[model samples]
Target: MKTEKRKLAIWMTMEAIEVIGLKRIVLDRDVAEAVGFFHAVIAPQVFATAERFGIHRVDVEETEDGRLPG
Candidate 1:
């Protein structure tokens, strides 16, 4: 279950990156959560990819559901 969730989260994050482009835009965890996976489990992977794309300075804001702010 955890692995599936992680994979789903990674896919979701990648999709978001593809759609939004790896710019200075904030990543709302709510948008990710709506995909139905836990952010904490997938954040490291997402951030890793962002880093690979040279997105070092990320702004992880908190929403009502404690999601990463966009």
Candidate 2:
């Protein structure tokens, strides 16, 4: 089996207390299938719960090499 690169953008921010708000999750075309599979196989409830109680935060970009911006 071969694993493909998944570029996922997750929005996150500090919620009041005891909970971190997980906003919207944008999965690129490469990772859209993976994201669906993950939710279906691993944790289906996560998507629902995230939508219910999470606030949409800022957008984050993902790079393959994981290099810091200079």
Candidate 3:
């Protein structure tokens, strides 16, 4: 028997206060790496907004293709 490898991608959406509004980001990485990237790169800024402009929501989706349907 043979197996095939598949590519994975991560889609993230964040809603912040009035200033930031809504932001969407995409990463071509596996779930673990994508989460790590978010913690390392995006989380700090998001946490900073927690005082006044808190984050409304954060969504993470995994897809074979790094894109949403048109």
Q: Top model by lDDT, which number?
A: 1
Tell me the tens digit of each residue's lDDT in model 1 across 29-68.
Answer: 3554544443443576778777776766354553466456
Per-model TM values vs. the true structure: 0.32, 0.21, 0.33
Most TM-score-accurate candidate: 3
lDDT against the true structure, each candidate:
0.51, 0.40, 0.45
Q: Write the per-residue lDDT of candidate 3 for residues 1-70, one digit (tens) a residue.
A: 8988754334435445411321222333356655565665566555455434543434234435633222
Predicted structure 3: lDDT: 0.45
Off by over 4 Å in 2: 1-37, 57-70
How does residue 26 of candidate 1 score in lDDT? 35
- Using TM-score as the measure, name the better of candidate 2 and candidate 3: 3
Predicted candidate 2 versus true structure: per-residue lDDT over 6-60, tens digit per residue? 6544454333531311123223344665455443433334344445767342222
Better structure of 1 and 3 per lDDT: 1
Candidate 1 has an lDDT of 0.51
Poorest lDDT segment (10 consecutive residues) of candidate 1: 4-13
